[model samples]
Target: MSIFKDFLLKFRESFKGTKPVIHSVLGNVFSMRVIGNKTHGDLAEIALTEYINEFVEDYSAVHTGKEKFRAKKFEEDISVTNKLTGATFPISIKTYGVGPLQLSTNKDGSMFSHLTEIVSKSEITNSQKIKDILKNPCFFNFSKVNVLPLIYDEKNKTFKIILFDLEKAYNSVSKVTYFPPRKYGKDRETFPIYKFFTADEQYIFEVRYGGAGANALQRGMWTHTENASPFFNEILNGTYQINEPLIKLVSKILVSPREKHEKILDLLRQLNGNS
Candidate 1:
């Protein structure tokens, strides 16, 4: 018999020789289990297939030659723009799996040296050739590049450049690694590092973090708020008066001298007390 068939026979025999009816009952249970496993596997495959198809279709639509905006690549930066809004933004995307490398470390420096050696060995020697070599999307060094946020002004048609500060952002992220496997020396040989390295990892960097990190969130939020801000400003612009009868009454209760704007101070005090 084939090795697979022999293995199945051994698995089947493990539940046998109890009683005649018991063996039959256990065989039925085993059959049901196998069928259920196959059904679940098939369903998962179908669902994955559907998701891939939908994603490909959506991607093609967004990236079609006639699409309004497309990703632009400069010497070392990438800028994504909205063709209709005249808004342009620069974004730096980086990976986290590769741990931070210190500038002074020999091992880190050697890695770059190794890369330089490989590039030098290549036939092309011109600046354009060097640019083409660096353009390979796979080779990303986390220690070298940091993600920076770019803001766009719809009114002025200009991009705002901001520095990235990632100080407290890493603290907020849950350090959970999915599908943890038992640690074994041989396991390293089987692990697919390339596949895992390609997967996109999400991190949260809030507004208060400051620098490049803060810029990242600020740029994204500003891009979203640009259209809504004018409408909101119009509705709320004339609602308050400098010296209104009703405003003076509320201002006395909540406004303090240290605060610059009385109207804003009262609102803040109310929110602070409520929270």
Candidate 2:
């Protein structure tokens, strides 16, 4: 190659090295708390899928969390494809604050019913019950279930991203203890909750049995991000840290008058050869 071509290539490589660690940041500039939980979650699902397509190497993503795809019992929000290997997998995206994170819901209450029977059976010991419960396919319906948690640390005012396999989580538990609703306390466990812990007593996660009726939706496996980060870290290497997203400008633009945005829209159309 020519000396000029070699120098140009080196310059491009050096510039690439200086790129920021976080390619895309997801979160609201204002309080994400102001937005309804479900709305923010849907937005986060789309944002993360786009981020993967744009930034993650050799990967393409498609959003699949719409009502049309509700047939998916696994609750997968997006499907990601490995371009090189031609492998694709579904991921359930969860958006939550730095607190007790709901991992998965008791969809159709099958898991709840199964666990209730297991817990009440007098023939099996508690240890054996837990072992049997974990062995159940209801907890793990598939060979691989991927979960991507986008945690917003309200205290630190930052966001964290982690993609982990749910099967690893099931295997990490060493013990399970049940906590029933308290009779006296103002702030008590409203329902019976089964807490899972690792061998060293690290809180892994919990399964809340929130009644058998309308509250069945609330009955889900929960985990504190800080407590469960270690398990997640081991699964997908680690988490990615991102600062608060620059959403003020985007929000302003969205809420601005149509007349004010007309010029910009025209320019965009012209750039796209639509004008």
> Can you give the lDDT of residue 134 in candidate 2?
79
Count of clashing residue pairs in every prediction: 8, 0
Model 2, 1-275: lDDT tens digits are: 43222322332242233443232335341144554446667777777676666556666789996784578767688887777767676777777777677777756666656666765422223566667787787776633445667676656756665544455666767776666665667764466667777778888787777455436336877778777776664211122332334445456788889997897779867885664
The RMSD of every model to the true structure, in order and in angstroms, is 29.8, 8.4
TM-score of each: 0.16, 0.70
Best by lDDT: 2
Worst 10 residues of 1 by lDDT: 190-199
Model 1: clashing residue pairs? 163-211, 163-212, 164-211, 164-212, 164-213, 165-211, 165-212, 165-213
Cα deviation of 263 in candidate 2 (Å)? 7.4
Please list the C-alpha lDDT of all candidates, in the order they appear.
0.27, 0.61
